[model samples]
Target chain A: MFFIKKNWLTGYITIVVKGAHPELFFQILAKHQIMSWNIIKHDKETACGRIKLADVMKVRQIRRKTRYKLSFGSRKGLPFTMKQLNQKRPLIIGFLVVIIFIFMLSNLIWRVDITGLDAEIEEKVSQQLEEYGVKTGNFQWNVTSPGNIQKQLLADIPELLWVGVKRTGSAYHLEGVEKTIVEKEEPTPPGHLVATKEGVVANLFISKGQPMVQTNDVVYPGDILVSGFLHSSDEEDTNSGTIVGAEGEVFAEVWYKSEVTVPMEQELQLMKGINEKKHYLQFKDIVLPIWNFKQPSFSEYQIESEEKDFYFLKWKLPVTYTKKTIYQTEITKQQMEAEQARKIALAQARRELSRTTPPKTKIIDEKVLHESAENGKVKLTLYYSVLENIATKQPISQGD
Target chain B: MKKNKLKESIMRSITQIFDLPSEVTLKLPRITTIGTIHAYIENHQGLIIFSSEELLLKVHQGHVRIKGKGFVLKMMIAQDILLEGEISGIYYEK
Candidate 1:
């Protein structure tokens, strides 16, 4: 065991000694504290033995005193093997380069797949990913985490209800569900149609209800215009009547009054469509501008900035990319006559009324009740009469 | 010669009485054989002759000769020699 350890560390060599009684040379070497092993006498004059490489100098000195001729044979062990490897430098370097290249390739995004979505939405999602620096061939460290990506996808694409982002090795997988607008059909119970506003009934289209009020009859809020009960109250057997859900439309005259004020002199800021874009890389609290070093020359401008985080694997790094767009704007002031201001105020009031009303409402008449101009402003009071549906479902209770 | 003989006898008596090893007290060669395949010799002076079928070593007062086939010296140190072969016989000579 000691010989094997020494042979591997310092190395060993086989030597052939040629002379009369060559074995005597090895005995002399042993006496000098230089151990030899595996001695074989090939012939009377030739013998071979293995000796440690460290004892070579001692053997040479002993050779001067003896007539035996010595020649070194095969060499073995770690030192020689290392020397041979050092001579082949290119092979070792090439092996290291291949290992590094493989490691880098493993950390890159090779493929991106989006599933459970339409082709249009899929393309939109991929484009959004590219904008976020998550495209194919991009380094995985430069892209944010899957959770952040999922959130960004949901926020940017309105058509997506829920989206899942998964990273598997060198690939990115996305599964999404599209938002489908579905109209709900509510189950209407046996009930009466009541008036939700104070108005006069202009028209009635009772599909499945008993009409309680006729046309041009005035009704108040909470008043039942249609009854779910088939029998009248004067009937002797009111409890025997069958109750049904009231489905109908009762058009009535609805009125609205509004007061609006408009400034005679108006100031507005308008965009000139000229803009500059700047990009920055932020590391913790330190921000470094990467592009668009020059500031915008416009005195009045608006800035819109967006920041994106960077990640390595599942960890969020303290680095972000910011993009800012500066838009040039101009302020303009205009003076208006009282008549023009009054017209604007009236139109504004009408718009407000229509916005607050339900769909399918018809504006039958509009009038400006009062108009005046003071302190560089025009104030107007307007009234509108609209024909709209006034029927509301009121479920019937057994106790009632 | 007579005095040397007397000293040798005293050393032998001391070894016997003290239960000491003869190889150390008397400067004698101790040869251990494992079946017929290997022979380990300790306290040997030097190698006298070696061949494919025989090995001879100088011991304390004489020479030790071993007759064998395919004889090879497995290892050789200052005071020990390990010889491996098919051993046939061993002989002592003055």
Candidate 2:
């Protein structure tokens, strides 16, 4: 009878019997090893009982041996429940579709809100976000994290002083501060314009000061090129002088010496614009290559891989989608002559010197002081003359 | 018939001496009743008749008739019958 309890999973059927002796039919069923329970007699000729669904066929076979009429009343259990569910296929499919729809909706970016920025900058940020796959209706997993987006935004948009990116549910909120340029105000105190570096004055413009040095005059650091004191030549007394702030430009020629070394042999790797893409799905530490299983036919290549994580609502899934781009590279080795190497070294030294100088400075002259080729390398020591503004404000002491 | 009776008596005596159950030794039906509401019969041969008010089952050498109100067979198997109702009486007929 323990198997009878297990029969509930297979199923059970209530049977109704109508005959002169329905109970006799059940007794005969019991004798035939077809078990039944809960036998209720409705009248003198009708009776009903429950039998395992498996015994229905045997019951039908035995029914022919007697004049009793047997009919299945109701079927119940897991098998019948499954059959009923199968009958309503559309309903179940609709339920599954609704669940899938909600899941997709939860993982999509619903809105992108940019605040605290001008319309121009906001439009630029929006365009940049679209380029990064952060626009609305896009899958959230396809976009980088908010911190990464903030870093990329700040790097790409120089006008953005500070930008804050926050992801709340399915919406992206960005707050940015624009860089404001402030104008500098001059000092009201009476000051002299002194030479900041040792140079020969190439040009001089005195806007509000008396010129103390002429063109072509060599001046040392801290030497006053323009004085704030105005002394009238007719007045022999220098004690009564008008003191004012000096405003002028003193252009002078400055000199720089730099040394550079260039190797006679150079090897460079250049991309040939030929690339292949491979895609992979990563679960934990396991990487499953999904697309482009064949390796690219390239001797020298570089691989650039980008990984995007999946998220369910606010939780990050362990699975990640990775895209790898393999670019073929060509390496070329160049053997240069000693003269060519020396020339390259001189140009490199001049370029280095100019980079370290002021923005408005001009290179007036350059000369190779020394050049030598040794140990497969060319070394050059070069001198450069640059014309630049040398006047620096120095406040005067009124007590003196 | 006389020899069968003598064998039955001998077996009954032997069961009594050994302190054994008669239902197991003599192949007799064992009927258990819970108050006046339910009756459970084991080692029964067959069901003679059954209705809402009465049930008759073939036991060892006789028929056991159960007269009750609203009699329902709670379970029916090869060797056991569980009857549920208001049991008014139980009679054995040879």
Candidate 3:
């Protein structure tokens, strides 16, 4: 405690005393109760030592009594530094002002983030918030209450099912849920069941219409399979049939033909582990690259980068360090066997047939009708026979 | 001189009977060393001689002579002196 007080408050000074009998000078200093330390004799005539800055006046009084020559060297300690700073008052004031300005600015919002919405809906929401005077770069104190904003948002957008507004520090968060719409069914006019494609009838079931075609009958597209009109039992009466909508199920055999060709020779691309690296410093949006003199010579390569951001506590600094790596790739051609090509074509043909075929179809038969090879390519033509419902409703016209 | 010797013997016997430290009871100099690199002497009278190769300190009864190379008087107060150097030997001369 005493050492700290001596070092920072009263401070200290080194003094060089040049005179005959310098030892006597130290004796006089000790006699006067002035503390001195680090006393060293330079030669027969000169000596140096340290004394407290407060004892400089005592040294002057002793100089008159003993007539010794004394000169001070350097001044030390925290007090002396503070005195030096006192001389440059304007610089200190400017530094303090800058610190206060930074503190004040940090208490205001600088960026606004909105997520969990589509681009068009996000734009609309942003525009709506702008009308409410809530936007980026705006002070948090000027914004309306979060509850009021949430209520207003729910009222303005009819499609929204719920809304939430939360404020954390200087950032305001607004989120909403959109309502799901349900579709209604429209009344269908009276119609008849017609054949949508040419097929051989395999099964028929009439529910609300008269059957026109029976099983094992071959019909073309646009042919009526079920008549919507019901005939009365009384044959002598005129206008005996009543028109209505047709409803029935007619199963038929439909054929699918698909042709696919696969090349015997193909190219393969492979990536080697050979890569080049570059490092850069990201200050905000600006990138300053280092140690990167030339671009990589690889014609085909993939670029991958990793970035790490600097942060202090909960605040993320705008500075980031990024490392980019470029991996080399090579492409080579190879020959495929005939059997391999045939297997690939068959798989692709089956995938296409399944994609085009309607749901709930029962496959009756499937075969590769023809196969041909020319110009390093193999082609296969496939046929698929299936039984599926082919009945479709056609509305009756006024003239009919 | 005979009377002073008798007084010293009396003081020594009294200190031994009371188990008092000699540095306080007899005004003896206290010397501490740290692996030959540093030496601190308390209750020292004055600097007898100082040099890069050797240093001598005046104590209560005799003088302590420190023989070493690169000797420096690191700190000095009224009765305390701190010396730093490669100490080779230390002895008292009456």
Residue-wise C-alpha lDDT for candidate 2, range A1-400, written one tens digit per residue: 4655677798999999999988999999999988888899998899999999888999999999899998889998789989999999999999999878877888899999999999999999999999999998999878877989999999999999999999888899999999988777855589899999999999998898888999999999999999998898788875589999999899999998888899999998999899999999999999999999997899999998888766666777798899999999999999999989887887787678768866778888988888888999988888889998889999989996
Candidate 3 CAPRI assessment class? incorrect
Poorly placed runs, candidate 2 (over 4 Å): A1-92, A120-134, A140-169, A175-181, A184-191, A206-211, A227-245, A394-400, B1-94
A285-390: candidate 1 lDDT, tens digit per residue: 9999999899789999999887765445445558878889999999999899998888888788878887987787899999889888899999888888999998
Predicted complexes: DockQ each: 0.60, 0.60, 0.15
Candidate 3, superposed: residue stretches over 4 Å from native: A1-5, A20-24, A40-45, A113-134, A140-159, A162-177, A180-400, B51-53, B69-74
Query: lDDT tens string, model 2, B2-80?
Result: 9999999999999999999989999999999999988999999999899998899999999999998988887888999
Error of 1 at A65 (Å): 2.5
Candidates ranked by DockQ, best first? 1, 2, 3
Candidate 3's residue-wise lDDT over A197-230, tens digit each?
Answer: 8899999988877888988899899999998877
> Cα lDDT of model 3 overall?
0.79
Task: Judge candidate 2 at residue B69 and give its lDDT.
Answer: 94
